[model samples]
Target: MQSSISLPRPIPRTALAQAVLLLLYGASAHAQTPPTAETMLTPVTIRSGAEQENAITPVTGFVAKRALSATKTDTPLLETPQAISVVTRDQMEAQGVQTLRQATAYTAGAVSNYFDSRVDSFSARGGTVTQYQDGLLRIYGTYNTSRPDPYTLERVEFLRGPTSVLYGQGSVGGVLNLTSKRPQADTLREVQVQVGNNARKQIAADLTGALDQEGQWLYRLVAVGRDSGSQLDHVDDDRLVLMPSLTWKPNAATSLTLQALHQKDKSGSLIGFFPWQGTQLPSQYGQIPRNTFISEPGWDAYDTTNNSWGYLFSHQFNSDWTVRQNLRRTVSEVDYRTIYTSFTANAATGRPARPVFNSDNRTVYRDASWQINGGRMLLVDTQIEGKLHTSSGTEHTVLAGLDVQRNQTSQSSWRSVTAAFDVYNPVYGNFRPPTASQLMRQPNVEQRQWGLYAQDQIKWERWTATLGLRHDSAQTDTEGRPAAAIDDKAWSKRAGVTYQMDGGWAPYVGYSESFQPLGGVDVYGTPYKPQRGQQWEAGVKWQPPGQGISAYAALYQLREKNRKTTDPSNPLNSLQLGEVKVNGFEAEMQASLASRWDMTLAYALTDAKISRSNAGDQGQSVASVPKHTASAWLSHRFASEGRGGWVVGAGLRYTGSQWSGTSAISTPSATLADAMAAYDAGDWRVAFNVINLTDKVHITQCLARGDCFYGQARTYTLTSTYRF
Candidate 1:
């Protein structure tokens, strides 16, 4: 489906002038300073003293004590006010995470819905979570954006609550940030081979080292290629990814890094569904097999390609001041096609009747349909950061920058009817092929946006405070009969305070707001106002001495307004009076116990409702959002001191019942299990991991009336890695 609303043209002249002036101000402060004796003796790079410390932080275990995504600074996780979860590379590997969703499945306040396999779908606090990489937005061409392999990432971080103060526009639920592998001064090389059920075969490699003596130049290269089969019969998924980066430091206080990525994916059709009678509820027909293939073999196809490059640069003018800048550009394209059954015919004299399968696993269908679509997208981002210390007894870290983005996407689709297949016992090669003449071009949307933001962090004595503000302007343009156009602007802000005490404890409170431009107009032809979100949060964090545990808990309430909903006067159009409220509590504990045991435990309880709406959905629980979720993971390793190196791990996850699409219908609760074992010797390691160990079959979610999806079935994988 194409977006009905479009972004307008370039921002007003005033906005453009402001961006130029900001850039000039940053450049004017770059006066050259006399070379000191220490600077003359050795070349200093950007990651000098403080930067080098962060770069070398060990990432060998599940516990991530420090993160930069929360405050864009080297702040410890325990000091951040809002609820935050970090999944380190070690944690992902131990859990046998193959996809991005799997990496966050055990974190508090996070729910991963992977029934479709076509897109990365997840919800936090009753709203969809936005995607980010290294503090920058990761643009998606459509609902089905490609997911990066877990092996290519260093860690994944989740920041819960409204964050528009730092990021211009986003979801009220929060943001998920993936940190990529970057060049390092240390020499490291590793390779791994993996194989599992479903014909899964893959190889990955990581190499990083200093390009020259004195560690002035560093480089890193990562690559992965995989060929795997899906639980769906006759369906296959394959991908290839390549990433390379280079870092150069000319002096102790100056450094610059350049990085690039190229990825491609080929997969089978994503539209596979059975009617309500046979799938969601027991029909007289036999239960549909989890691996049933609903689409014709000849018509199923999906392919996408992406390319991106960017740079990170920073310089420390003196002990009290520093400046940093970042920029990136990306382009992506996709092509998808599929042919599947639409309606079913009854087992008795099936012809001409909306086909319904019978108890004997035999049925006939009235007909089928073919759908074809393709599109392209482009994205860009650039920003600058600065830090300063005042003459008074206070410290200041500030950021001022501008970002501009343009997205142009177009889709051409064709649909036609053909002969159908048996529901229980399927047959292929029956549907007729669709033709180009039947294809129709959808409305192409071109959206452009520009935002200017500034933030400051102030610290004095044992007290810390932060304040930020941002301004955004956007224009959406659509190409169709009338060539519709709309322009919008918004302002966002955030404030927070924290107090630190001696026993490794910190208590904080924060307030933030978010906004997102909506795409459609009301029945009266008036553009709908952008959706707005407001949140109030309070939390406490603790890190006990010598216990290796970091824990936190938070309570929050969020409300959103100006949402678009069905118009009562004209059922054909939309209204902007929709409102929603969500209240929740989240708690988490992660530790490396006694240097031999690692454990992580989390729990979340949420209550979400449609507070107001033009339609008749008020007072109902949000669809697909469970009220309670909990998880626990534990692992133990035996050292070589008394026995051969070995490790054992296990985990459990539980999700409570939730409204599927209406207050009257709901999906049942479920529990899942996972286990892993590994052995290490002589710089080599072997491991076996199992997901859904109990082989339980349950629906992750279902749509009203007839469409439902099953969660991942029991699966196992074995991997071997060697380091040199």
Candidate 2:
């Protein structure tokens, strides 16, 4: 794309050379210093999985003592004054979480497990959720981005509400941040092998330790290989993942960590968007099995690979000041091909219907040709943090930072029509696939962002207040379409106050705002303004002293405007006159009730409505948003005889009814059950998890008349892990 915006240049060679010289000088100047007691001490990874020594209290069960997403600083969750949830590694392992959605299924206000079976995509409140890695934004060309291996992460944090005050451009609903396992001073080794339904098999290994006796160098390696089958007759899912990381500490005040990952996924499209007649309701042609494969086995294909590398460097100039920098580069490619049934007849016909075919036969399909997609991203951020005391003897934590990001993607596709086939007994090899002559290419796109932000946390006695502000400038361009270019600027702000009372009770209130630049232009060829979101929240938190329980309840309302809606006059463009509002409440509790029992409880209620729109959607309920959701999980552990023990866990999840975009279509409410059993002996543990234990069949969501998606069916997995 031709653009008038000037891109930032790389660091100058002189500056790079100076940095190298300074590094050498620093190392040589401090190499001969006498070793002391602090030098002999090893770096400790706290219970919250934080590398810093001064972290929150040790956490167990489903409760996390601290969260990093709320402030980008290590702060206790109870004192952050923001609604946040952390899925600890212990919790994910207990649930046998395979996908990101499964890892957060029990969290309140998170609605997932709907579409994008290949990737992790969810909605919080009433807006989309964006994924971040270690507080850095990962560029996504579309909603369906590359999926990261869940096993590689040490934890996942969700900050629920407008977060643009820290992150420049983002969805107001929330942010999901994945923290990768890094090298720790303590030596650790583990190996795991798993077997599951559909002939699935997997092997994984994790190793971390000091590379040298001086403990100045540390390294970690993680690898996984998997092969699995899907619910479809011929589709399969397979993957290979590898991650390597290293840390170098020249002194106690300075540390550098380098991390890299490579992943390859080979699978078929998991989408089974079936006609409403046969999927949502019974049809005259009889019902299709839950595992039916309507698409041609020969034409379906999905192959993708992702590579990412990053580094985190932190230096403490003194006891009260620190500087840190983080940078990453990522590249990904995708090849997809599938032939899906687009639609069916509106009337109760006895067969599938298509416009290309002359008659409505039991089988009618189109040839969805090959599609290629590619993406690349570069992100960099540098910040300085300091602790200061006010004139009144109060304390303050201040942080200032600058960040830049550049991302781009390209896509091209080919397709053609096809003849009909019988549904009862389909026959293949009769029709030839489309050729390269019918290919179509989409315009290559690029987006760039630059942001500057600052935050201050003021503490006086039992009262803490946080204030933040950020300014962002972004631009978007299309390779072959100059008219689609956009340039936008936004300012975001946030403020919160928390009062810590005796007996471990904290009451808090917060307000935050967000802005996201929209990509396309309106019908009149004028660029649309960025979407603006604002939220108000109030909550109370409690953690009784000496008790193993943490509880919280929050009430919040969020509204967004400048949304784009279909333009009836042109049909080819959109108009920016849409708005949505969500009013909700969330409550959750995690407790270690006794010596052998642990439990978690959660509930959420969301009322999302279209306040304004230009497409006749005003006053309608937002699609895929259930009004009420609740869940509970309990586990019991049996005493062990020397080196053996056992545990059993059960959970229940409830989802209330929700309306589709179409007023007449509604997804019915449903409840599902899950169970797990595990045995621990010596250095090994064997566990089994069963999801949807009752084999309930329900629709996760129905978007329109002929669009319906079934919830995941009953599935089980057995895993064995050995520690050395």
Residue-level lDDT of model 1, residues 199-312, one tens digit each, is: 999899999888999787899899999999877887777889999999876556666678898988887754465555566677665577788887778667666677777766
Error of 2 at 14 (Å): 12
State the lDDT of candidate 2 residue by residue for 611-657, as single tens digits. Answer: 98878889888888999999999988786322248989999999898
| TM-score, cand. 2 | 0.92
Cα-based lDDT for every prediction: 0.73, 0.78
TM-score of each: 0.89, 0.92
Residue 140, candidate 2: Cα error in Å is 1.2
